[model samples]
Target chain A: MTPHLTARNAFIAALVLALFLVPVYAVWIGNNFVLSLFTRIVILAIAATSLNLIMGYGGMVSFGHAAYLGTGGYAVGILAFEGVTSGFVQWPLALVVSGAIAFVIGILSLRTRGVYFIMITLAFAQMIYYVAVSLNRYGADDGLTIYRRSQFGGLINLSNKTVFYYLCLVILMGSIYLVWRIVNSRFGMVIQGSRSNDRRMRAIGFPTFRYRLACFVIAGMICGLAGVLLANHTDFISPAMMHWTRSGDLIVMVVLGGMGSLFGPTIGAVALLVLEEALPYVISVAGRVVTGHDVATAKEYWQLILGPMLLLVVLFARGGIDGLLASLRRG
Target chain B: MLLFIEQCLNGLQLGLLLFLLAAGLTLIFGIMDFVNLAHGSLYMIGAYFAATFAAMTDSFVLGALLALIATFLVGVVVEMVALRRLYGRDHLDHVLATFGLILFSNEMVRLVWGPEGRNLALPSWLNTAIEIFPGVYYPTYRFAIIVVALAVAGFLYVIVMRTRIGMLIRAGASNREMIGALGINIKLLYTLVFGIGAALAGLAGLMQTPILTASIGMGENILILAFVVIIIGGIGSIRGAFIASIFVGLIDTVGRAFMPDLLKLFLSQAAASTAGPALSSMLIYLLMAVILVLRPEGLFPAAGNR
Candidate 1:
């Protein structure tokens, strides 16, 4: 193989290896925090991946993708609250409900184009958020704490930290693989074709809307699964999960990792979340070095840098991290 | 009956505040074709600046005036430094860049203002209640908001319909390139438009500060409402914004006030109590969805513009 492909492959291999070893490394260091953080990263990576299917490939810039996250979460939380703790029932219900909501929202929102589409999606998500907030029985605005994780009934032990982490990692890989296959399939092609020029695709006898809608529903279902994992991972769920800002964060992950690539969302998830985790320490350390006293508020100001960094990426690195790596290989 | 009238007036006040924010958003979107998610940041900044200035000067009027000018400048500088580069880019780019701006702005506010929210106290003269109808009294400050917002709406109408700049703005919205071909300085016009938008958002923010207090993330929820107004009103159509803003404002306020009672008529007391707030919050969004289905181009699409 050429060095170009080799370098990219090597990087992917390295990333996979490192992710698989995170728990072991954490245990060696006696740091449970790292394990939990990586678990969160893997779960969100699934979300970012699903978002990428629509946004990167299908050209649907949904500002309400987090709605499904909340949907999936609330399904699990509400079900568990009502004494339905079986993963068999809870997981499927999460997926089905998320898909149903996406279907409804997709029908209404898909009629509009450009900014209207973005705004409509956002509005629908906000609608869901309000619904979640008003669910007084399930903890409402303060969120619901799941005292018992989804009971897998010996199929898997989710309460065990390492086992849960691996399950998430496995699911993340499975999603990335599923997305890769879908994007390369005819359905994905139609979605992409519509994205590039919907009129022409329609002229060529493709029912682009149905295809796009299907793609939208699938992405929502996958993201719903991620939400299921997230709720299980944290043992809690809230309206905050579906907030518009969280949607923006998912978009940022997709863009930061490289849209349209199979592994872009995963990479973006790691990069964005890791940056979120590390930037404060980096800022504080830099502050202490520059000034002689530790800047107590340095952590809170990390977003100040991240915000500009996003702008710079938009301005210059339209291809994102994956794109950047591809360029390195080429050069 | 008095309470109902009072709620209507409250609705009117909220509607007018929405118009100020939506007008700026629609102008920027309609004319320049930029999706500025950070417009809310400008609103937040306006409130923050008003709070700081009011606290410093110990005079509400002086503080609001200074805050308005400061927000306008911030808008202009933001345009020059960042947004100018983003024109003609994909709407997605605009969304992402401005999303970043939202994050940055929030952090910046927290860093500068500390984490706590700031309160903009009303002047005593504006704080008292006035009887609009016999034995039907309303807060003077809220009544003042309605009056001021209406006057600004009138001002906006006159400007957009009668003035030379308004002519240019209308022309620009309808056909940006043709006017540029006609030797108009498009860049400067865009900057001026953006600054005006900022000032208008600032005005809304400052006006609201006395009621809601200046707080971090205050701009976001209302920003969505402004978006709904623009969507319902029609992009680039000031007339639509005016009508739609009031409609949305009334639905939101009156619905929140009365939705519980309405729900209780159908649902059991327990269910009504739980669902009331949720349904009320979603009233405007439901309206927007219906509007989208019926009139995708909004109620008042600008002439010769999509």
Candidate 2:
């Protein structure tokens, strides 16, 4: 096999092993809560993967994908608050609304290119955030809570940790698989070709706008699914889910994990959330051992590190972890 | 009728503040072709500086002046240290790097000032209201903001149209390579331009301190509005920014003040109450979308390029 193909297969094998092993390891160590965190990682991985489909493959950088998450979460939260407990209904509603919002926003925003596209998407997300905040009847700025997870015809128990973890795992893997197929399909080739050169794609007798718009909508719908899972996981949905900063965090995950790759978002989500959980304590311990002073508060400033890290990655490591691995394999 | 006039004045005041922000944003984009998201950070810094300096000297005017100078220097330093390296890079790179600076500066502020917002109280002399008409009294400080903003606008007009440096700036906006070919110190010019832009943003922030709460993320809300202004006015066009800022400010202010009542005419009180604020808030963006559809280059594009 060619090294590229060998590298790709090896990466896929490593990911499968890591996914199963990490959770098993968590259980073996009696740190069962890692399952919950990993579930979150899987859910967000789905969201970021959706984002990568458009941003990495279609050259459409949306800085407002968190809106879909919020929309999805709000769909579940609002319905639960109003006594709609069916998973089938709630999930489809989330997808449809997210897609509808994406279609509308993309129609207007896609008219602009580059920075304007980014800014307009951001503005639309902010608009939705404001709408969420204005809903005083549904808890407003504080967010609404799902009294119970969605019911699945009395078959699947969403509240069980193991079941929920596997459910998220299945969805995430499914999303990655779907994205892989979409990116490699004829339509996918058109999208990537548009990313590489939109003018050329247009010149080659392809009406590229519709393809890009469809890609945008699909990505939005996928993120919306993650949002539904997130609400179910947290049992709450707040306007914070859709905040611009949250959108920035998603972009960070996509870039850090390596954009455009199927498993990049999965790896990124795990790494970032884990770092968030562990970094503060680690810093404090390291600080105490070195200087005999408590420095737990340093974790509060982790964003300071992350921001510069993003810059360095952009400037020096444009390919991210996935790119780094591929280059190492080539060498 | 008097209330309408008062609201109009409020709109004008908000417009002037937005113009200060949009002018700087457009200039930086127009001339340097650099997308600086951290421009809002400059606004926040200006407000913080004003609060600190005013407290130290117990004189609002003195504090504001000091804040302006300090913010200008900070802007120049940031340009030299971080932004200079970003020039000629992709827009995405500029966004990422500046976004980093935003994170770093925000944390630094939190470290220095803590999280809670502080009040930059107006001086006693400027605290009183002045009767503008038979049935209307306006805050003297707000009137001062309008007046100062207008003066700056006039000054900006003269600089862009009549001055030698303004000529170079305009030329640079239209064609950077040719101006560089003419042997102008492009780096120095860029730094100066950025410093001036920062000063304008600082002036807006400092002036608004007495009226609004000075806080860590205050620049954020207004930054979006400024972006809207720049988009409506067309990027790189100061005159367009000025006109668009006033229009947006008017639309936003009037829409917020009256949209709920207007909505009540059609929808039930509950629905109107919910949708009123949201729809009104989206008016400016709707305007931007329509503009993008009809006039993608904006009403008055400075560079006039596709």
Candidate 3:
């Protein structure tokens, strides 16, 4: 009710409202495509939230976060291929594997700081990527397709578009809530403080390494959930899901959404996914309307536009869309 | 034994190529304190330039020279326009901005030259194998790469250790503020240093193009290797980068080529076949993790002047 509500709070409300209303609207409009798109947004938002937890809160700039997504998705795909389709079993297994891998990699990589940490994370991720690629049994580089969505003992049908969309929405909202709680909690304060000054945190008698590793594991586990959701959404799993560029995309989401904030990752996910989907259509339409020329061929160059847009944002808007809105509201 | 020697030579050639790329990267980071992720883009551009020029001119040497010059100019221009603003900013800002450059350049390359891989043929003279010993005849082109890389390393050593400009570079690497306070034209120096780094990366890209396939994402894999080298060598230390590049190159090349057979000795053939390639590719990383444990700073910290 208050106009003075901070943009972060406003964004959180809007996201929650959108999550509830979008699928219903999609059903009413009979355009379930909207549900699928927003479902993707929600899944990625969960993934980005995990990244933000470590990067924004814990001060660990991991360049390999997508490994969890890949790991999670592959878990479902591999399990399904081996004829295990139970969502309950598959999801928990994925989360544990991701968390365990993150813990191991974090322990080794956290020994180094700055550029070395970045490279080490990258190396570990690449190691996993190669392993995934070498798994000829699990479809290797070609990827595995899920013939059916996860079975939930008839309690939930992921194959039902509406049910699946709602399931993803619940998870996404739950993740954001979890991130909010953790960031506000004593643990979150310590993580944030460590990010601000790690040496100082250590000097103050905090075992910064353990805290950061724990944060890494949590973030990886959350991303693993996102991976599970993503596999459910697409009914596919491939090593491509964990490619470094995907990690870059996650970083882009965190930065674009305004890093360090609770709701920023969701905003970033919504903005980037929508932009990616809409830019070509909008540009082609504008070209026809303005010049009466078919610019369909030029649609392929849409990423060129994105490249410049990201550059401009990095140069001008350090805080991202949510940050920009907050400042404008303050003004 | 003969095959081992051949693999070792191949490793050395690859190591030298990596050294060329890493030297520039370490130098720029050491002196400018800028983390230019787009350094790999320069390598990509170098390969692209070599392909284009070599195709146009029908002479590999001429093409390589032209590519080198073009890459140097592009490096200087990029430094002037984008990198200059990032000097005083946070390392994160540099990372983000350069990351943007990576996207832009990759797209630009796709726009200019289609995404399909280009094959730049090595000239017949350079393509032939040379008898380095009675039983070991290595690719002449690869030998040339090693020679050129070694010469460049020697030149860099002299420039950094002996010359006035080198003195300034060392000074700048150790402490930028101190060098600036000494009334040096820090801006010009930075531009020159960046240009040199770009040229070195370009040289490696061009030289290795014939032996390695030229493709859109070639830089991506090698870029990670360069980073591993940088991490192992110690950031901002050219000597560290050089040594680490060779170490990584040897580990990677030889490991990939031989680790399956090596693992076969201990494990079942099926297990070795499955695990060998993955483990071999991971050797450099294992080396890096071990190095980090042993020496948080690289093997040879840059001249200790920062």
Which parts of model 1 have CA positions greater than 4 angstroms off?
Answer: A1-4
**lDDT string, candidate 3, A78-137, tens digits:** 999999999888999999999999998898888877766676787778778878887877
**Candidate 3 i-RMS:** 1.6
For residue A218, what is the lDDT in candidate 1? 95
Interface RMSD of each: 0.9, 1.6, 1.6
- Looking at model 1, residue B8 earns an lDDT score of 92
DockQ of 2: 0.63
Chain B TM, cand. 1: 0.98
Clashes of each: 0, 0, 1
lDDT of 1 by residue, A228-300 (tens): 9999998899999999999999999999999988888989999999999999999999999999998887877
Clashing pairs in 2: none
Candidate 2: CAPRI quality band: medium
DockQ of each: 0.83, 0.63, 0.59
Q: Identify the superior model by TM-score, candidate 1 or candidate 2.
A: 1
Best lDDT among the predictions, by candidate number: 1
Can you rank all candidates by lDDT, best first?
A: 1, 2, 3
**Global lDDT of each candidate:** 0.93, 0.87, 0.86
